[model samples]
Each structure stands twice: as C-alpha cells, then as structure tokens.
Target: MATLQQTEHNKTVDAKNFSRRAALGGLLFPAVGLFLGGCTRGLTTAAAPKVAIPEGRGAFALRADGTRAFRNHELVDQNGVKVRFQDDLVEGKVFGATFQYAKCEGICSDMTQQMKKSYQLMKPIMGKPVNFYMFSLAGDSPAEMKAFMQAHGIDNLPSWRFFTGSSEAIADIRWAFGFGDPNEETDKNLAGHTGMVRFCNHKLDKWAACPAQGSPESTARLVVRLFPSNERPQLAGIASKIATPSYPMKNWSPAKPLTANLASQL
Candidate 1:
C-alpha cells in the first residue's frame, strides 16, 4: 500500500507538471493527452489582436526579418495604446515581452520570475521608449492589474506595461505572437498556456524568440558572442524545448542530433 501511495504521489506530481505544460500551450491544443500535437500550445499568429502579454499567453516574437508575420498584427499596451510594428510601439528602445496571468501558481509564475530577472538585467538599456509588455491570459481589469502591480512594487517602472484583453480576443491574438494556439477548445481556460518572450528593435520588421530566463542584455551579449555561431546551434541553445511530435512550432525541428546532450540541457 505504501509503495502504491508513492506511485500515486508521483503520478500526481507528473499530472500537475503536464497540466502546467498544457496550460502554457493550452490555446494550442485543447485536448486531453500527453502526445499528438499536445505541446505547451501550438501558437499561431494569424489575424488576432496580438495576444496581450500580462495575462494572455501567445506569440510575441516576430518572424524572419523579411517574414510576413512581421508585417501584420497590433498590440495594446498598459497606457491603453494600440501598438504595432508600423505604429508608435517605441521606435528606438529595446523592448521585452512575456505572458502571464493575474493568478498564476505554477509555470506561469516561474516564467514571470525569470522574466523579472531578464527585465532587470535589461533595465539600464531600457527606460523612456524602452519598454516591457507582459500580456495576461486572464484579460484582468486595469484597476485590479494596477493594484497588483503596485503591490508587487512594479508601479515605479513607468515604461513597463502589463496588458490584457477580452479572453476571446486574446485567444485569437495568440496566433500573432505564436505563444498559444487559439483554434482548439476545452473546459480548461487560456490560463494554462505560457509563452516565450521576444526582444525586438521595434523599428525592424523581424521578431526573435527569447530564452526562458536571464537578462535580455546578457542574452543579447551572448547572442553577439555567438554571432559567428551557426544559426542552428544558436537556436538550439536558446529556444526552449518541449517533447517534440507532441510540441508545436513552425521554425524549429527537433534537434534529433541532440540525444544525451539535449537531455543534459533539459
């Protein structure tokens, strides 16, 4: 019975982790299962409003420089402003983007912690015009969001905006940021899927997916250091991984060559 209980406990923990992962990609595939395209969420950035960051989980990265994904889409920031590539989304400053919700307890929370560390590292590099936008999967009210932000001591960061929108709107917008797939449906809400951050020049038409955590400046410096590195290794080292075949993404193919080396990274 004790052994059975231990096994049960392990199963519970595993289930929770799986739920969190599914939540990260909840918008992608709203079905129950571990395999198939059951990734964190097979985010697709189509015609949606560009999933709001502070709460909604979805795409934030721009596609290849010349990619069409870079040309379309718009996002609303904390100041109640609608922003996009061709718009006043901050022209010269480095910007950061992430996804979270007002009441996340698991991976979303962990992502925020990592995000904060990354933002702090990039703080000096950002200020006026240099901004950070975190979209909410919840589309929480501004009043509630502001209060919570202030409580967390995040109010002083004038340039950082926590954004959210109608749940349905965000579900559609997630496609633009590639953070979640909005096509599927289930009893579970959008809160489950978490997404990656993207650092953009704001002036360029391109978007690059960011690392899970670490300062953006640090990440930037690392990228520069790795400039000569083949794009393959750079992507391999930076992009977060999910068990493939089960995961969803258009740009990266599972680094089948990863083997034991990839396992260590995980």
Candidate 2:
C-alpha cells in the first residue's frame, strides 16, 4: 500500500510539471510580442521636440512645441556674462543642447562629466565649428559661475556655452527643451529623474533626445558624425591630465572612476 501511494504521488507531480511547461510555452510568444509592442508604443507616443528659437542657426526651424526660438534669450554665460544663445552659431550646422547646474551633487555632475568626456572624444576638431550648448538650470550666480568655470577647468573652453535665467524662465526653457523630469517625486537617486541629450537638426527642423542615464557617449557619437574632424587629443595635452586611458575628447569613458564611485550611493 505504501509503495502504491508513493508511485501515485510521483505520477501526479510529473503531470503537473508537464502541464506547466505546456502553458508557459504557449504564453512565450505572446508575452514577447506584448513587450515589444509596449516598447514601440512608448517610443512613438510623443512627438519629438521642435526648435523654438527662430533667429539663430535654427531661425527657420520650429521647436518640439511648434514654436520658433529666440536668437538669444537672456542667459548668463560661464563667465557670469549675459550672452545670447546664438552669439556663436556657425551657419549651416545643428548642435547639441542640455542643462545642468554647477552645484549639482548627483546626476548633474555625471552629466557634465559625460559631456566633458564627449568633448574630449571630439577634441581633434576643437577649432572647427560645431554647436554644443549647455545651460545651467541653476544659473550659478555671476560669482558662482566664474568660480565654477575655474574649478571645472572650463575657464578657457569655448566649445561649450552655459546659461541661466529666472526660476520661472528656466522652467519654461526646460519645458521647451524637454529637460526637467516630470515624475521627479518618486526618484530616490540622481538617475531617477528624466535626463536626456538633445540634438538639434538645423536642416531638418527636428531633434533627437536620449533618456538612457548611461548613454551620453552614444549620444555624442550620434552628433560626432555631423562634425567629423576625427583627431582625438592626448591626455598629456589636456589642461589637466587624467590617469585612465581616457581618449581626450571622450572625457567620460566607459568607466569614469569618480562617477563609478558615486554610482554606488545612488
């Protein structure tokens, strides 16, 4: 009687296992299809941002908001000087724009470092004209902006432009560029907020922004094709040399030790 009971239990277990396998197999394709559909829907759901400033390199273009941008909105430069966004626009080219504050202790810092790495990656063509604009969402005060430039070694770098306006004005600018994170309340870490690199296409009047918190390099590469002066600077030539095998313009390499260390706490 004991042996018969044990055999019956084994048979029951085998039947259950087979049924589960069959069910899971039947669900696999549908599950995969749903996942892919969700991703596709997510990407195409929103219209790409438009260029609102109509006077500068993108004067003829429209922003994601379907509005034209001003040539130079009142923004403070890294030197604490009020400068126009189109002050240094090179005719016939698109550019990349993003916002960051100097005092940012979290994602902002990483974002800067990432752009710096990207700048290094494209260093060989430093003198040539390509648009790269960075605005300080915080608008570090004139004194703060001056000090921040020195601290970060951007005191002489002309390739990047920083800007800041009033809190309300900045919010409008952020919305125009799609910079601020919408669901900021739930994010516990720096990356929890929305962060993206905006690439403005002057000719097409379109832009592409990336949200992957770790993909600035890829974003840089996408822009690199537009500006192909392919000479990378050496570490020794930098204003301050870094120890890693950092390809000069590629300031944020695949591994940024400082950023990597910070990632642990995030």
Candidate 3:
C-alpha cells in the first residue's frame, strides 16, 4: 500500500511538472517569435537607406502640385546680361512665357502681338508687379532678341524680358516648359512650334496654359486669375461684372486628354 501510494504521488508530480512546462512554453514561444521578427524587420530597414528626393530630378524641388521642372542653364537676357533661367527670372515670380525665333513671320508674330495686348490689359488691374519671358527657339543673341522685340513694339515693356541660350539648352528648356510634341518628327519641325502661352506662379507652383491665338481678353483673364485674389481686385471685380461671350460651335471639338508623359510633367 505505501509503495502504491508513493508511485501514484510520483505520477501526479510528473504530470504537474509537464503541464507547467507546456503552459510556459506556449506563452514564451509566441513572444520569442515576435521579438525575433521585430529584430529582422529592424535590420532590413537599417540596411536600405531612404532617399528624401529622387536622384537627378531635384532641380525643381517639386511639390505634390508642382507643374514641372526648369533648367538653371545660363541664359542671356535682352539687355545682354547673363542670368540663371530659374534663379534670376522665374523663382518666386508670377510670369508668362512664350517661345519664338527672331525671324519667324507667321504664328510667332501673331503670338507676340497677342501677348502685347494681354500685358496691356493685365497692367492696369495688377496690384503687384508681374513679368513676361520670351525664350528664343532659334538661339537668337541678345541683340537679335532686342531687335525682334523692338519690331513688335514691345521692347519698351518694363516687365517683359527676352532670353536666349545654346540650341541644345533651349531644346531642353522647351520640354521643361511642357511645350513639345510626343511625335519626335513633329517636334523637330520648328515652323510648327507650339503657339501656347505658358503661365506660372512659381511661388505657388500654379501653372496654366492658353492658346496664344486665343482672344487677348481670354488670355488676360486666365493669366490674371493666377495672381493672388487680394492682388487682383481691380481685374477680378471687372471680370465679375462682365458676362462670358458666347462662341459659335460650328468647328468646335471636345478637348482631348493630354498625353501621359505631358500630363505627368505638368
């Protein structure tokens, strides 16, 4: 009887010990796995460093709504002064840009004339100073750009400036301004260059474009809207009082969506 009781007691002790160990292991194993997994994740994170800005594309320091990038290439102004394109002319400024050569007798002339009218309309109501830039697609010298401006009767406009650079640089700049055709062959045709006017409020990163061939009033309205509401009271009030004119739709077509690359850049 004593042997039997002792054996039974030993079996109970053994069962209790095994149960305790099993319960302890069940609680500890999950915690150990979680700790090990966390260590592995930390090591992986430490191995691959994060980059703040993308490589080779930080020239613009773009924001979520940033329209596009610009080159800081050296450019010559109409006054024969060398200036950095973004730093000297565009940074923290509200401006309009047009592209043309010194010798174009077609749409370039019309575009310049339209821009002159637009500026005149924008001047009276603008509370703050704004600028206009004309980049030469033909890489015209400062003197040539001055001559072109003089012939257009816009050389005396204080807020306007003309710029020129090497042909290669100008080519790159044009695309930066979102003024290129996807079709390489079409883009190479200089005579068929874009007639759109690019508008930017660099400080706000707001960008817009309008057809240079459009009515001066239309273009002026669009550009004026880029200015701060407080700075455009006169123009904004005038616009509010005027009614939108009706246009004939005989030849009108619905606007198509921009190409993917162009859309992404802008």
Predicted model with the maximum TM-score:
3
State which candidate, 1 or 3, has the greater lDDT.
3
TM-score of 3: 0.64
TM-score for each predicted model, relative to the true structure: 0.48, 0.50, 0.64
In the range 150-254, model 3's lDDT, one tens digit per residue, is: 999988877687888876567656655656443445656777888988776665565678888788888887876665665543554226566889988898898
Question: Residue 53's C-alpha lDDT in candidate 1?
Answer: 33
The whole-model C-alpha lDDT of candidate 1 against the native structure comes to: 0.45
Candidate number of the best lDDT: 3
What's model 1's TM-score? 0.48
* lDDT (Cα) of model 3: 0.62
All-Cα superposition RMSD per candidate? 17.7, 22.8, 28.8
| Alpha-carbon deviation at 73 in model 2, angstroms | 2.1
Residue 185 local lDDT, model 1: 39
Q: Find the 10 residues in a row with the least total lDDT in model 2.
A: 32-41
- Deviation in angstroms for 28 in model 2? 34
Compared with the true structure, what per-residue lDDT tens digits does model 2 show for residues 98-172?
666667666765666676666666555443444566656554676666566667666566556666666544544
